[model samples]
Every structure is written in C-alpha cells, then in structure tokens.
Target: MDICHEAPVKCLAYSPDGKWLATGSEDCTIILWDSEGQLVQEWVAHAGEVWSIAFSPDSRHLASVGFRREHAVWNVMPGQGAPKAMILEGHTGLVVSCAWSPDGTLIAAGSGDKTVLLWDARTFQLLHRLNLFTLEQHAHAVTHITFSSDGIRILSASSDGTVKIWDAFSGALILSLEGHTCGVNKACFSPCGKYIASASSDQTVWLWSIDDGSCVETLFEHRADVRHVAFSPDGMTLSSGACDGTVAIRHIRDIILVQDTDM
Candidate 1:
C-alpha cells in the first residue's frame, strides 16, 4: 500500500480486467501492482522520466512514453519466454503520452514534437505520422491521447489549448474542439463515445458534444489548474483532479440524460 518511486510518479493506468495497476515515475521506472494494491513487479522502463503508460485491451501488454523521443511496449505479465519490451522510434521531440486502441490493434503516442504517431499493435511497426499539415495537428506539445470506445476515432489534448478528433484508420482530421483559455492537461472520451471531457490550466473542465463539437457544459470548481478528467465505465459518473490536489467526482448520468432528451 505504500509503494513509491525515487522520483515523482507521473502517470498510472489500470488494466481493463481490473486485475493490475501500473504506475510510471519521473525516476524512469515503472511499478506494477496487483488488484489489491500489492507490489508485483518493478522495472526500468525509460532512460528519462516516464510520463505516460497505457494497458492493452486484454491487460497483458503496456505502452509507455517519456522524456525520451521513443515509445516502448512492455510485456507486463509475461509468460514463458516472452519478450520484455519493444522500442519504437520516429519522434523528433520528447514523447509525452501513449495509448492503446480499444480493440488492441493499434498503439498511439503523443509527443512534444506536436504529432501523434500510430503504430501497428501486432507487428510493432509505424502506421501513420498523423501530422501531415500544421492545421491537422497540435500547435504545441501533445499532452494526452486516447482512442474512442468504439475504436473508430482518436482524441488528442494539447498544450495548444485545444483537443482534436481524428479518423483512426485514414489519419484524417475530423474536428478541432477549442475553448480552453489555457493549455489542456488531459482529455478523454465518454464510454458511449458521444462526448469528450477536457481538463485545462484555465481551472475548469469542459464537456463537448462529439456530434456537433459544441461546449455542452463547463465545470468551474477547481481553484487551480485542472489536470485530469475521466468518465466512469458506464458513462455516468465523471471525475476530475486538479493541481491543488483536489479530486472531484460528480454524478453525470442525469446531466447526460437531460442532454439526450433535449436533443
């Protein structure tokens, strides 16, 4: 229960099956814990601070990125004779965030290079650069990236104070949702894939309708920069964390239900 790293922990992820929890630290290492919070394994994952980590859909593999300009996929729960990790190259700037597609077919990495690189999950080969044009990508460092629940789209939050939606397979820009006055720290899709929630340095979280890219609601409770936001698995509850060390959980089922009814 008191597990820690030599440096500050930067990111964490829970396996889809709820069996494992993984944490990455500024110490350049990763620690794995069991569902009950018992330390299971620990390893050096990056030469520099590990900024982000994401578990595969089946909860076997983990994709991680860091201050280094590369991504690494680890076999967190290896069986007999399994490989430890695979190094991915191609980014020119520090890698900041990573995510696995919902179907386990693709892996996405967001970088300080201001682009999202998509990789083939099976072969570990580069799939798309995703920044063909300046308008199609973030104007600043990409802070976070995630695949939609349906696996058809990708959402990326950036220091440019905007979030962009993209067609997953074609690497085409779908929509750019902008409203935050300050940089966005994180973003995530609703479980139903109907909306996006973004946390910003502006000290608020904004909910956006995916259909029209409209600002559905703005939550202004945090006194400091809002750092993260996540929706409950059933797409009901919403949770946000702030730089002031406050974590807020809200019952959003009713709010979303009202929105649906109004539509």
Candidate 2:
C-alpha cells in the first residue's frame, strides 16, 4: 500500500479496466504501476505539482492537471512509454482538477482562475470556458469537478463555500448548493448520479440531492478539514479523508435512517 513518490503524492487514479494505477506527485512526475504493483512506467509530467489524474472510460487515455496552468493527455497502453498526446493550455492559473466524461468525449478542468474549461477529447480543442466570476457563480478558485454518470452534467467544488451543477455541453448553470461554512475542497457524483457529496474546509461533508439541490445530510466527526469524499462502486457506502489523518466510512442506509429519525 506504500508506493512511495519522490514528493507528496497529490493525486491517484486507476484505469477503468483496473489494470493500471497512476500516481501524480509534487515532484512533477507521474508513475504508472500495474495491478500487481510492478512499476510500469514513469515520466516527468509537468513543471509544477500534478494536481489531478483521471483515466478515460475505455482505459486508453489518462489525463492530468498541474499547478502550472496546463493539463496533458497521455496514451496508456502496454509497452507505450507514457507518450503525451496533447497539452491543453487555457487556464490562466493553476489547473487543479480534471475529469473525463463517461463516454470519453469531453474533458473538464477546474482552475484557480475561477473558471472551468471543457475540451473536446478527440480533437484536443477548446469547447467551452465556464466562468465562475459573476454574482451567480463561485467567487473563488474551483478546486474539484466531476461529470455525471450520463455525462450531461458537471458538479464543481470551489473555494467559495459552494458546489455548483452545470449543463456540461452548453456551459449553463444548473444549481448551486451552499451550506458549508468554509471553502469546498472536493465533490463527487454518486454512482447512480442522484446525489453529490462534497468535502469542505468546514470539517464536514454535505450530501446533496441532485434533483432539488438540497443538503440531505451533513456528516461530521473529522477533527480537521475534509479533503476528499468518494462513494463505493455500489453507491451504498461513502468514504471520506481529512487533514486530521483519519478516514471515515458510512453506509447510505444508515444516513437515511438518521435523516428519517430527525424528520
């Protein structure tokens, strides 16, 4: 479990097929390991800290974002030595997060410049620049973003104490879920795409309903800022990590029962 990197590992991702694991580090390198934990390949991926990594749905491509305001797409195939396919450059600030659409048609990146940029994955062309600078949008850096299971919607977390849902194709704002008292650090869509879970500097994770943008539950217990949140493959269990060096796992059924009891 201890795959050491030269510097702090900022992000980790597994290929959709579960054959390869990729880790990005503050040393500006990306390392690939096979399922057996054998090092497959290593490459200098960026000039600054690699902030995020994600694999295409088909497991053929890997996308990475860095603090250097650029993101790169790499071909991930056996015997292919981490060849860079394209570099996406549009953000004026650090590119903090990246995710590929479910069908592998689009890639979305969040940046410190208060915008989310969408790209055509096939052609590596800029498709849309979603601005979060207005009164209706996030007022600070976008820290994390995820696409819905159907790829029609995007959920973004920001330093502005809010999570916003957007129409992925049209770049139109959908809904903003605000309840956290501090900046949101990470957000993820449930496997069923019916809910969004967000971690915040407020030391809590808020579970929001996608239909009504309502905060259904606020999970607390972490003694420090929550850094990440994810749902199990079955969407029944939720896991969270925090700066307190603790991880918590809760079952969705238990959360529902708690909600019902409160009601």
Encode model 2's per-residue lDDT on 1-263: one tens digit a residue.
23556665566666767677677777788888886667898988888878888889898889998876869999987685556658998899878788887788999887878888999999999999998633347898677777687769878789999999988788889999989999998898877677788988999989988878888888886777877677755666676656544556677877655654765
Candidate 1 lDDT over residue span 88-190, tens digit each: 8889997877888768999888776778799999998998997633435688877777767777887888899999998878878999999999999889888
Clashes of 2: 0
| Candidate 2 ranges beyond 4 A from true positions | 1-9, 12-14, 18-23, 31-44, 78-85, 90-93, 108-120, 123-142, 145-147, 166-179, 211-224, 232-263
lDDT for model 2: 0.79
Number of the top TM-score candidate:
1
The C-alpha lDDT values of all candidates are: 0.79, 0.79
Give the distance in Å from residue 144's predicted Cα in candidate 1 to where it truly belongs: 4.3
Cα shift from native, residue 70, model 2 (Å) = 2.7
Clashing residue pair totals per candidate (backbone < 3 A): 0, 0
The predictions' CA RMSDs to the true structure, in order, are: 4.8, 4.9
Task: For candidate 1, report its TM-score.
Answer: 0.69
